[model samples]
Target: MYEYIHGKVIEYNYQINMKKTFQFSLCGQCYNVLVKLNSKAKKKKTTRSPSPSISIAASEDRINKNEMSSEEDNKSEFVLAYKLFVKTADGISLPAKWFQESISTVDKFLLSVYNKIHLMTKDNTIMPSYYFMIFKTQKETGASTQLVDEQDFIKFKSEYTKLAARKSNIGIYVTILQPSITS
Candidate 1:
């Protein structure tokens, strides 16, 4: 069986063996599913692996704490670093590095980026509600994905840090949606 979500297709497999079960992979991680064949079927005990994003969030918290402490030692405030780009008619603009302090929510971070874009381009038509943001895993590959508003930002940063094999700033792409005309 296959499941589609957010432009990604997930493949699920059923194993016919002594223990009947299903397995699937999502977001580069694998998971096992237990099926109850009949009403009388006894529930099987199974252990689930921690979600990749959850684990990444935990690690990111630790990393953030360490970063703050080290920056304090240097008598400088710690800031979350990001590279921002706006997608326009021509193409994505050159990345601009933004260092933000004490932003915990995605909405607030996006608002800051929106304000920065407005200031830089002096575009009055750009509305905060009309634009959405995404994180690009690689600049050359253009592998971008939308993140949930909850804890996904931390997870994304953690993944980027791991991919770069060091502490690195995140790259955010902002795309503005045009208002629809109704006749």
Candidate 2:
């Protein structure tokens, strides 16, 4: 409590709005091999990776340290991850590749989910409920326990444009989202 005689108004203005949050959960299969990934694989340096813009590999240091980490103890390590529970715009909204089959790799899943959301969603801020993160999981429960940082949300938006340009032959149109509406 502030004394009315001594307290001066220093800060003002606050908004009351509940923003929907998005979150991702690891597929059991992806978690199985996430730790075994070498530096190259973690960086997604394989021939099949579409481009650096669409890549979502963890850093070299993490991969190196987790080199010998058995898949059994996945609850012990931290990795960058994101989630997208896609709500379509009344059709098969997912890309053609994903429409037929499920994603298997964490890197691929991260790229695909981010790409689709960036491509289709009007409001890009997926926070409080959904997020991109580097989180350590709980060993006892295999649940995310610690957060490192939020992944660069704007970077995903940029990647969507770059991917569309690079794959122009596929004829994907890039629409710019207004900055004020989304963070």
Candidate 3:
């Protein structure tokens, strides 16, 4: 998965999409550990598919964040971006050398499922902007929960909360924070 994201980072870099970003192979052995997690989720049937509206909204939000399209007063002062492109247009690919076979299996499953995920949070706007391109996965409850990059979402949450602190009405603002994916 990391390798795939690394490829995305490269693409964005080459396309001049992301200007301030860096890539590194952190904890090569950890990829296997993460992949193993996917198998466990599969066995437990913990996969979910996000609503189509949510998927589109998330992708658009990512584009906006990357472009910093919000008004200065409406934008969050803190934002982070991550890349996740695994395959080349011509089918060339890189092997993920982080985990063992078990983990590799999980990584493969997630790579097949999760595809690309981008997260963003903005403030001072009418609603808080949250978006993701979640993959389909079954949830432990025999229900599908859109599989998403928990880490990237976490970063968005942290930054969003900080921006939210300045708002007067949390509940009212919270409602605005959610993306109108359906529209």
Query: Which residue window of length 10 is worst by lDDT in model 2?
Result: 1-10
Tens-place lDDT per residue, model 3, 19-120, is 457654644334544465445436444545556567546654654564464233223333222222222223433222121111123234344323221112
Q: Sort the predicted structures by lDDT, highest score first.
A: 1, 2, 3
lDDT of each: 0.53, 0.36, 0.34
* Candidate 2 residue runs with Cα over 4 Å from true position: 1-98, 101-104, 123-183
Best by TM-score: 1
lDDT of each residue in 1-183, candidate 1, tens digit only: 122121132223333342345564543112111121111123211434457567446644654576577445434323456667676534546456565555645666666777887775557667766667788643446556776554566566557557556654467777756532320
TM-score of predicted model 1?
A: 0.44
* Per-residue lDDT of model 2, residues 31-132, tens digit only: 544444444454465456555554433443554355445242332322222232343333333332222224333455346545565555645554223433
Positional deviation of 94 in candidate 1, in angstroms?
A: 5.7
Better of 1 and 2 by TM-score: 1
lDDT of 3 at 82: 23
Model 3, C-alpha of 125: deviation from truth (Å) = 50
TM-score of each: 0.44, 0.20, 0.16
